[model samples]
Target: MLVFWNARLVFLSVPKTGTTAIEGAFAPHADMVISHPPELKHAPLYRYNRFFRPMFERACKVEDMETLAVMREPISWLASWYRYRQRNFMQGHPNSTHNVSFDEFVNAYMRGDKPAFANVGSQAKFLEPRPNGTRINHLFRYEDQSRLLNFLQDRIKQKVSLERRNASPRTQLDLSPETLKKYQRKFSAEFDLYNSIS
Candidate 1:
């Protein structure tokens, strides 16, 4: 979701990155524009699908926009995503009927074969120049939510309270060393970008 004032606070909502919480905090204070779903879309800053450029440009043209996003360690993010999907299966989402295991999901993700999960772009999309040459004003890390909240509070001159609701269950399964290595390679770019920003 994108939040804007006369001054733009464009939040690039990345999936599983506390976006709903961010939206709740900012919605009362800013004009909220829903961009993409948490599972399928990353922040629409850079590396966004080419088709989204026109819409984004139109939105930014009307306001003084400052871009922001939240990110997490990719492995943990993906694992959380997998578990969330698994829970959805348990809850009887029609789409989750197949009910693939986490191990299977990780294999597909590592091979870049999970089409639904694979296409979400890297953090570089937010941190670097866009394909359309637009640049974000700031990028935040999910790992450092307090910092982002503080920054937003300072910018908007209003105290924002973040609340975590509908949190996914924490995994009890420990990642094997080999699996960790595989994920590190699979998400190397995002890992680097997340580290740099944090």
Candidate 2:
């Protein structure tokens, strides 16, 4: 997560949504950057409200900072996770996807008891609105980099450049129609959230 205190903006890093690239690009300009401890790095809305929000509200006396996030197409997001875990360094890890087909991986993901390899967190849950109505002020589609960059440049008043970082391995991934249907049904919240992003 990158906090632009002067801009009164907080960019929440949703995993696998090209947030790493954005963080790298904006790190120099950000007032505070949380890049360690994956849990805090990808602190979701509830976490933000529980932790960061109170800190700012009490200490900084800041109550209206806007938040930003990005969501990728659901299937592609899952595919990225599958490929990401297949990297060489993760070969023997319990969460490695080295031996699983994309189909099997996704099937496991839908299980109530997901295997470590398929336990990636949901994008929808990551950005869910808080009960207090704290929500993202600017939500961008990961595929729509132009708009995201445009918004950042306008807000920060500086030209921004991005270089791809932490890309998942290349692979041809296709979900069978039946599996896709099941996934959509089971994870309707994810699809609904992405669709609502515009």
Best-performing candidate as measured by lDDT: 2
Q: Residue pairs in steric clash, candidate 2?
A: none
lDDT (Cα, tens digit) per residue for candidate 1, span 1-198: 556665556667767788788877777887665644543345455443343445556864543455777777777677667666656435655324135655556666666455564333455544566655566668777878889999988877889799996587655545667777887786678778878774
Candidate 2 weakest lDDT stretch, 10 residues: 167-176
TM-score of 2: 0.98
Q: Please estimate how well model 2 matches the true structure, expressed as its whole-model Cα lDDT.
A: 0.92
- The models' CA-based lDDT, in order, is 0.65, 0.92
Off by over 4 Å in 2: none
* Candidate number of the best TM-score: 2
lDDT value, residue 95 of candidate 1: 29
After superposition on all C-alphas, the RMSD of every candidate to the true structure, in Å, is: 3.8, 0.8
